[model samples]
Target: MLRNSKSGYGWIAITFHWTMALLIIGMLSLGLYMHQLPQTEPATFQLFQLHKSIGFVVLTLAVLRLFWRLINPSPRLPDGMPPLEKAAAHLGHAGLYALIFALPVTGWFMVSASPWGIPTILFNVLPVPHLHVPAALGSQEEAESFFKLLHEYGAYLLIALITVHVAAALKHHFISRDDTLNRMISAAPGKTDN
Candidate 1:
């Protein structure tokens, strides 16, 4: 099925989940590598542009994914799941979605307020315009720095949440021996593992 069913995720949701996961991993790795580079180099500038382009792609996909989730509810959790675990799952997912949205917005705001005057050329084709910043922000540099901190911290928090998510998934698969992970991976709608 193309859409989510009560038994498990559909093709679209699985595609979105795995694709975003891969892109996020790449972006995070590239970001850490770029951070250590000498910023003044022409190559460093190119790297920053690449990072910004990927960030926009992530933001776009996140918007689509959120919209899809709104229309298609996720399958119910394992029958034996405890209330605490369910709460953690809900909060963890919310945190993930928040970071997925926040990181890009903050990065865009940071670039928009940057005094460096660099333009974001998406994939070397599309031109992305900066947001119109308010005058009350005082200096462009100050605004950029503030949003930069938000973006940076947001990335760290995202990494932590992903770690927890993966660990929980693995626990469900191995220790719990439930179909919790399998439903997202591949499972018939509403089927039980016996």
Candidate 2:
């Protein structure tokens, strides 16, 4: 039950999916809240640190999840699904994974290029290295602005993808009455294709 089956997802896949989903949602909300605070507020710094810490955690998890996914292939789509639908599912998953990697990296670059030059002490415990951005590219302000825009727009794209992902899952479960959602929720070994 730990490995994926042709018919359904296993415990590991389900755990990774749900855990990352929850963390991403939390990170998005936190990012929005932190963005609204004035730079001078003491709480703003604390929140930014928390956001960066969690972003690093998400980045690590995303790498692990992608590795696991490569080793364990996803469950096959239910029979009778249109070819277009299957293709859309694949594209949606790819987009999500890309965003998962991108959002954190952009955030890290944004911090590294910060005009303030503040160190990122993750969770107030361990120090994380800042990414090296070449001085020749532009001013620190310019680099920060570029990465900040990327990070923000990337998050919005992620939100849009998540909405489509959820709606599709609901459609599969309710409209199609398929095992797509059930496979993720249940640990029971699915029926094997002979």
| TM-scores, each model vs. reference | 0.95, 0.96
Q: Evaluated with TM-score, which candidate comes out highest? A: 2
Candidate 1 to truth, TM: 0.95
lDDT (CA) per prediction: 0.89, 0.91
lDDT of 1 by residue, 23-136 (tens): 998998898899999999999989999999999999999999999999996877887889998989999999999999998989999999999978899989999999887778
Give lDDT: candidate 1, residue 37: 100
Candidate 1 minimal-lDDT segment of 10 residues: 185-194
- Model 2 spans > 4 angstroms off: 190-194
Q: What are the per-model C-alpha RMSD values against the true structure?
A: 1.6, 1.4
> For model 2, what is the C-alpha lDDT against the true structure?
0.91
